[model samples]
Target: MDGDKSLFAWVVENYKDGHLICDDQSGETADFLHISASSRTLSFIHVKKSGSSSEQRKISASAHEVVIGQAVKNLIWMDFTALRTRLESPPIEEPACWNSGVKGSDRSAFLAAFDRRDATSRTEIIIVQPHVREAHYKHLHENGLDHEQISEDTLRLHLLEGLLNAARSTTTSVGADLFIIGSSD
Candidate 1:
């Protein structure tokens, strides 16, 4: 599989069971959104590729900034009402891409999964990078992010603890949660 497909598959597999994953194909939406029916969690993931030279390795500072910007942009667009409307009437050109089967039965299940009102109660923004390093984090801290903007929840920095934990889980290479910004409430 190509890089994009591989990354999407990895995300679906790593999210564990009881999660409904869908591709946010609209250019206006994030790359993907994962909804946990049991937990009532809604998470948006923005997958970004590092510069060609940095592929499979640490991301460049500029690339990292771009990823963060996209995350913030998606978060701002993640209005619960808007999301519900979009899900209910998904774009005609954009079809649902469940992690599992794509049969008629799957379509019924997908619609049911998205029909719940609880899924949009909580929100998370995850930036999936190929890899990351301590310097990258430090750089983001020093320059990429604005504390004032974050405090206002404009970028959802408060919900980033999970992403930080994920990043810290591996020292040698950052996994899925490279840069996460999340809603506090």
Candidate 2:
């Protein structure tokens, strides 16, 4: 479950109980979409895996570029109306991205519940990057001091931290939350 696809599947399996989980991995949408009608929440999940050990230890700005970019760029899809329309008629035919979970009659009910939700509904962009160890982020911020003798990894993590902060700020401005889920190490 460490890989991107596996982690996505894991989310579907574990969180699909009371949610309309959509595996919209197509380039057109988020990697996975979780809609909880009861909670009135929609989560757009983007996933990425570390290519190297160093990347797993600290946030790699280059490695995160695509995932973060996708999360930000697809903010237009955060609308319930747009999402319902897209889900009602997905563009891709072969290997459909929104193929799994809450299909057929169930999808209608899910969409109905979604439509019932109001402006207070919460939406969030979740970036699940195991590559970015949480410890590195906390240490860098908590122990902020002279970076004169900082290692390459620390510098890169700092850069990625800045990027994540900027993304968070931007997401917040639009009445959405931006969450970066990294390893608790």
Candidate 3:
């Protein structure tokens, strides 16, 4: 597929500052993502199963919301070789923690390193981590979900509740919900 200009450039230019939520079972690997960022740079947030870390950048969630709004976008993983060809910049794969044979080289370590570099350089290696994967139940969980065609309504509600819980403690006011719960009548 052809790449988007604004989103692609934003993702390419600001990799280090993008949030990265490496779930407990997440594998050690890098990704090229299209996270919604208002600024030219990104503010990354990684919420692991055990706990989580603050965004690598100095921007506020409200600040980010103002610019990005509620636009749904795509974030896919592209290998190092492809980046070199597209950006016209020579490939420079510095020793990354995940494959570096270092301890705790999962999502957490990369987030930490990205945070440090993002702060110092104001720009570093691009790394994007989306909060939740957008897929239907059957598509998302593969064979884990019920075989019967699950309703999209059911899936959206389930994901929304989980997302709310995940974003509750976030400093960025990103999660926007427009629903009301009923009391036991």
Among all candidates shown, the one with the greatest lDDT: 2
After superposing candidate 2 on the true structure, give the runs of residues whose Cα lies further than 4 Å from its correct spot. 1-5, 23-27, 53-56, 92-106, 142-148
What lDDT tens digits, residue by residue, belong to model 2 across residues 33-147? 6666458677788877665556345557887888898888988876667777886665544322222343333355555666777888888899877776777777776665456
lDDT of 1 at 64: 51
RMSD of each: 10.7, 3.9, 17.7
Number of backbone clashes in candidate 1? 0
Cα TM-score of candidate 2: 0.77
Better of 2 and 3 by TM-score: 2
Between the candidate structures 1 and 3, which one is better when assessed by lDDT? 1
Ranking 1 against 3 by TM-score, winner: 1
**Model 3 residue 37 lDDT score:** 26
* Candidate closest to the true structure, highest TM-score: 2
Every candidate's lDDT: 0.50, 0.68, 0.29
| Clash pairs detected, candidate 1 | none
Error of 1 at 59 (Å): 5.6
lDDT of 3 at 24: 17
Name the runs in model 3 displaced over 4 angstroms. 1-40, 45-94, 97-156, 165-169, 173-185
